[model samples]
Target: MNAEIDFAPLLPLEWLAVLAAISAAAVVLSLVLRSPGWALRGLAALALLTALGNPSLTQELRDPLPDVAIVVIDESASNAIDGRDAQTEAAETELAAALDALARDPDAPMEVRTVRVDRRSESVEDADQGTRLLTALEGAAAEIAPDRIAGAILVTDGQAHDPEVFSNFPAPVHVLLTGREGEWDRRLALQTAPAFGIVGEEVDVAFRVEALGDAPEEATRFARVEVRLDGEIHTVVDAPVGRTATLPIPIEHGGSNVVSLSVAMREGELTDRNNAAVFSVNGVRDRLRVLLVSGEPHPGERTWRNLLKADPSVDLVHFTILRPPTKQDGVPVFELSLISFPTRELFMQKIDEFDLIIFDRYRRRGVLPNAYIENVARYVRDGGAILIASGPAFAGVESLYRTPLRSVLPGRPTARIFEQGYRPEVTELGERHPVTAGLVHENAVQAAPSAEDADPGEGPTWGRWFRQIELEATSGQTVMSGASAAPLLILDRVGEGRVASLASDHAWLWSRGFEGGGPQAELLRRLAHWLMKEPELEEEALTAEVAGAEVTVTRRSVETTPGRLTAASPSGETLEAEFVEVGPGRWQATIRAEEPGLWTLTDGVLEGVAAVGPPAPKEFENPVSTGAVLAALADASNGGVMRLADGMPDLRRVRPGRTAAGRGWIGMARQEAYSVRDITLTPLAPGWLMLLLAAGLALGAWRIEGR
Candidate 1:
């Protein structure tokens, strides 16, 4: 038992200083006056003041609290390589017996918590085991108090990428690593590739082969990589690595192309699971078919012409209506300088032939009747693309907004024109969006400016358009907003067709070097391609690219957030992975899916995308034959490193607080407790008797002092 005195003061130490001064003054007065009564009075006052300071005795008792032990087991991909599986089972059984014996002990004070760290096999890439350890610790710590934690025991090979996270742990961490020593191997790494490339074009893919631990110095490993197009091997190549190898694989069709690359693990290699990977690439059309119509020639007419003509692959059919359909000019049809507009031949006869139709500064003229306008709407609904670059005429009574095409256009023209020169900026959503991503003010520096006052040095910064259609955006994604969040550029789908409405026709001036041109060509290209259902423009797609035996897989989504990529082998094992962004709106990762077969890749939330291959080479088929490669992790940590040949130990139990051990089992004994109490009290005075005694003592002292 322990006890201590604690004082509770009514006043602060500063008041105590005042009391000391008063006592000193009384002493000085008594000495100067030669009064013995003054001395006695001062002594009594000091005793009374001291008694008023409250004090009490405190006692404390301690009892043993439960100690918690956390056991973490690694079940990642590398842990399952060889005989490590059996080793893991044996360790678990021994540990379980130790825990059971401790729980049964009458003096044990420890509790055991078990955690398993498994590989994210349902993904596309290798999962790091160390990350899982940190996660498990975080979870366990949250559930249990830090003060009660005794220590942590990890059963792993220690192939963790993040060991630094363990440094801040409050308890000692012990590793019982499981793996054999002398494990060495090789792996295929996909170096690089473009996420999106034009069909029929040769895209360069770079890759390499890495030899891990004691691989032969001068050994040559032959890697056979096959490029598959829609489940068929389009091309195959054999390459020797250690040096960077670039393979120019042609994209045959436009869409998601799944490519698998496989490398044969050398004979007698440790493990073969890392011998292959898969990559995906989005294929895009090489050219676009555009049909442009103008009711009357304007400055924007030349803009569309120049833009389309700039690309050699673009097929442009431009038609201008020099005269209105209602005009009764005296000039003969043969003498007219312009040919009749082929409205029927184009819209009614073969509207599906064109990928995109752009109507620039056009009105509802008699050239196209109500029936033909309805036909155009039907064409857009049937997987065609349309763009309406509206001008001032769109606000008039004859505006197409009043025609059958009005139902498909994004906004209704309010005829309000805001002429202030404002910097053209992409909306917040457009920053990461595929259509206008990376096309902000910085991209404008390269565009041709349309204003005379614009300085050549200034270039065409992101500047505002002159007019806006003060119309509500009822449907689709509003990519560009003007003053007060006014919809400027709207993209929406109408019956399988993509439609875009640009509120201002002056956008052409930005393309013509008026204020220094912006990224007009790029913006137009993305818009046109996106409307044509190009795979690269898809909001979400799973694609793969192969160069030799190294493949880089990619998953593209309209959602800016990144999602996990899961690749499944025919054996039903899945690998969860993540892709990095190599360019705007593109996420990719290089993995060697070397075994080949119909390897399936997915984000799990989306559809399962597949890559087909004949069994890569029979050499790396056995993924679990090597025991040496499986034990490297056991040697790194201060754990007993042994092999299956060494023989497994029996389980045992030990005392909890003392670390006592038994046979093959380790146990923590349970603690027991009982309680006891005692109480006592004492009185300073016995009622009236103490008062009478105090009076008699006072009288005796006074009489004696008087003499």
Candidate 2:
């Protein structure tokens, strides 16, 4: 509250000065005459004149308010790694306790607000300590009264990725750091590899190796690195630390190749998981040429053409056997009805022109002699892919199963044809197999409502086909099963070529909506891709994906369920990890592969996954400290930026509108503007008697003077 005085007079200051001069004159005359009565009269007139001026007092009222404290907590991925999670937990506990104690104290007079800083899914590089602090302060000021907020405290590891954008805080920011100063000896890193590499070509991969922590300044360490191609060691080298090593790795084959790089940590390192990494590089050939041979015109003939035509890189030569030699459709000899089958030109003359041959619902229709089928088998044996989609004709007298081509087929067809509707299901071995894994009906279903909600009696849903050839399983893998666990799909390798056999020709019904439709296109697409040696379909594959410095290592196995994974660096140091089930039958593990080198990750069964080169590109690789990020906010708003290396500072009170940091915690000292309303005002004057009172006073004075 404040108070002041204001005075109002009916006469001007000049008139008052003249009256004082007249009184002084009277006093002088009295002194000259040696009379004390004149001096008494002059003093009385001066006192009466002063009483005519009016004065009033004005006062204001105010109430005190509480102050606020802002607490900022870091919740990024780095804070969850190593022992930092425990440190964060401890800091949260301490902060909560501190706030509770302050709230209970009678003299504290402070309110606590907390802000959590986490990774924003949209921006991976924006997680910084200073930005979070400034953001918290701005939020607190807007929500709470600025005069109520005292200061702020931040909890983090001090490893801010973006340090340039700090500033704009209006309160003091104190930091509570998490990690201790420890030696982090990491291998140098090469972070990423191109997705596709040409076969038999040399590709340059970028990588760097550095020695961190209390590494001997003058002493150098040798890291033995090995590059593996398709699970086999293709190249090996020994490189020194703290240098950039360029490795020229050759892409050996046209397939999905897994390349891995590993480097060993020093003897007394804290963690060994950062020593290795795995990369997946697709090996592509210059071109793919396919030869399509159709037995006759059928409803499903366009399916084969559409599948091959979808890929821009595929060059297709299609030939259809319109009429078999034995079928006598009477016509003139010179009539041009359809082109000849051209068996001699395609099979005997130019057999090696295509990389793959597809026989869609083909049969031994006497279109080509037995010798032509033999030649086709030889062509497949010498590194060609053959796919046979069979119809009911395969079980009839014109069965191709009786031809020389029968040897490459995964199953032998029986004369009997059993037709029934059945859902396509993965066999026991196919669940863990890469080609069919995660494709079963149960797995395809979205979220499971509950464990008990799964229908046990309802068989898998599949459309009914009018005809299915009975088949006897052979040496190759039985990838799909039907009612009573009968083989529906089979794949086998003959020499260097691959062959697949589907027991039913009615699979097109699934795409045609015969019952509830399924992902028919997806199924057929995966089947064709697997036959083309796509890397994601390998039965036993090792691959890893890198996010920042962390690598998620996955080992895909068709057989021999993997147990534990042991990753060894190029320097021969090994770190053991357990495989966690990520999906139905896949096992995965995450490791922080901080360094760049050849990392070899092997399970106990001699199978391994490797990252061929180095760590990935990251913005916050170097370690440095700068206060510029938070300086502007601290300076403009009178906030103090204190380093976590120093202990937490003492809290202080400051007057509002003053600089934040003066001699004490209180800002500059100044009184706040306050006022009280609803004031009462009453008149002290009445009307109609002023003239009579003036006349009576003048008459009395004149009478006294005359007497």
Candidate 3:
């Protein structure tokens, strides 16, 4: 409660001033003349002025408003590192207790309002956003006026994502870091990664191994650096600590290639969760070198030439045996236009230069000797690709299978040929294999083989073939079959190379639009790429993709579901992913990611990898708790930042113009805010009473003058 005196004058202040001046002049004149009646006149004038002016005493009942203080606790992903969570909880309890005591104090009162911020509330425009306490603090202070705000305090690791919110804060901001002293940490940093690179070429990756917090710079040296390409460990090197290293990575296939780099955990490290980083670089092919060899000038031979010529990436080297050694013509070689075949140049000279070699109905005619065949067989075993398009000759005596190439060939002809038209079909494995999965003939009028033409009542949309060589798969997967469900296409891997055989040479019949041409081009394209060791076409594999906090895992197989896959998080925790068959051979499942980093998935044999956030997440980039990021805000607001690990400092209330923190104490400003509840007014002196007093005083002074 408070009380004060107030006045209300009947006459204007200027008139009152004039009347007082006249009374002062009269008193001065009377003093000069030595007249006692002058005092009586002065008393009457004072009475008149007093009667015109009204005054009263007012008593007010006021309620003291508690000053508001905002306490922001950061719960971002990085804050969970080490023992920071426990540290934060302890500091919060102490601060709350201190604020409660301050509010209960008799002399001064304050209100503490706490707000917690985490990565969930952070702006997702950038996936790797750090702590966003400043923005949240602004919102928390929106309802309270500047004068009512005592101050604000933040408990975090000091990695703020938004700095603009600090420009116009209503009160001072004090930060309390939540990490212990001498915390050691080593994190991988990807300084530069390209978005695109040509296949078979080396891409440059610039990176660094940082030693942060209490870790010594010398600890960074001799640390094992692991590099993974497409989920497999490609290489390991001893990288220098605190320095940048350039890694030359070879692009494997034409697609997105994920590159993951990680540093080994150091002694007493803060956490290994942030030691790994990942990035993706798309691989594109520069050119496709294809060597197409045709034994004779057949009608379907032009089909192979046209398809290879249409693609700009394919550099086609085509040749047909215009005259075999078996030909007994009357004309001599000198008289006719005949060019010598470069068997030595093609077979042994630069065979490795070609990406693929296609054999279309070629028989031994003493042209390519046994040595040439042996060299070709050696080429396939040495990581080279080969595709055989057989004809009637494969079932006869001059079959290429009878040569040294039989070792790597997937299938052998059964000395029989189906000459009747039959619709081509994809085997169970083909439907799930990357090369044939979701394959469709765009202009095909049929969605499936005619119910009468297809077995099991369903099959792929395709054209009919006039003939196919009956064969049995010797080694490898039979991806496609022909008439009576005979093996038509077989894919195999021998040594380090790949081999595929299409039993029928009449595949060109589909290209000629026989009963509506099928996916001849697409089928041939995929087969050629699969032989070239395209990563996507693997018959059995695992792949993963990240979408925000969820990871989608896909398994491709020729057999049944490969049981349950295990995913190990960055924190070394395992999650079992139950597979659900989404297609013929593709099984998929999604798991929610709790944190951001390199996540690994494996199914006993094959492994897959995915990255949830940025290459180097901003939050993980600086895991060390420091006051630098929020120091400016604290300083500008007259507040200081301190480490919670040191000890919980005293919470004091300071004036707005004074410092808010010191060596052992952090303070909140005293707002001194209040509200008035009631007010009243009453007259002090009445007009009649003042007039009577004035009359008596005048009468007495006049009587004294006469005596």
lDDT (10s digit) by residue, model 2, range 342-408: 7799889887777788777788877778898898888878867787777888888887788999878
Candidate 3 lDDT over 354-419, as tens digits, reads 888988888777778888889888999998989899978888888888888888899988989999
Off by over 4 Å in 3: 1-64, 77-82, 106-108, 119-127, 180-187, 211-217, 220-224, 230-242, 252-256, 268-274, 328-339, 438-461, 674-707
TM-score per prediction, in order, is 0.48, 0.52, 0.81
Scored by TM-score, the top model is 3
Q: Which residue pairs show collisions in model 3? A: none
Q: Write one digit per residue (lDDT tens) for candidate 1, span 1-707.
A: 44556655456767866876887787687678876565455555554445444445655454556667778876765666566667777877877776666555555456789988776521233221223555676678678766666555666655544444544454444455566655556666667867798876878888776666556654446566665555556777776756668878777667766566666656756666566655666787777789999878888889778878887878899998777867887878767655677889998998888889998888877889898888889899887889888777777877888999988887877766665655555676665667887666445334433445434344336545666556567777777776656777888899889898877677775676555556767887788777777766666667766453355677666555567777776567676677888765678866666434456676665544554332232222222223233233323321222333344433233232443222232222222332224322222333344445545544554564598
Best by lDDT: 3
For TM-score, candidate 2 versus 3, the one ahead is 3
Q: Which of candidates 2 and 3 is the stronger one according to lDDT? A: 3
Query: Quick one: ranking by TM-score, best first?
Result: 3, 2, 1
Candidate 2 residue runs with Cα over 4 Å from true position: 1-131, 137-290, 296-303, 306-316, 322-356, 361-384, 391-407, 413-470, 477-488, 493-497, 503-526, 533-622, 631-707
TM-score of 3: 0.81
Model 3, CA-based lDDT: 0.82
lDDT of 2: 0.63
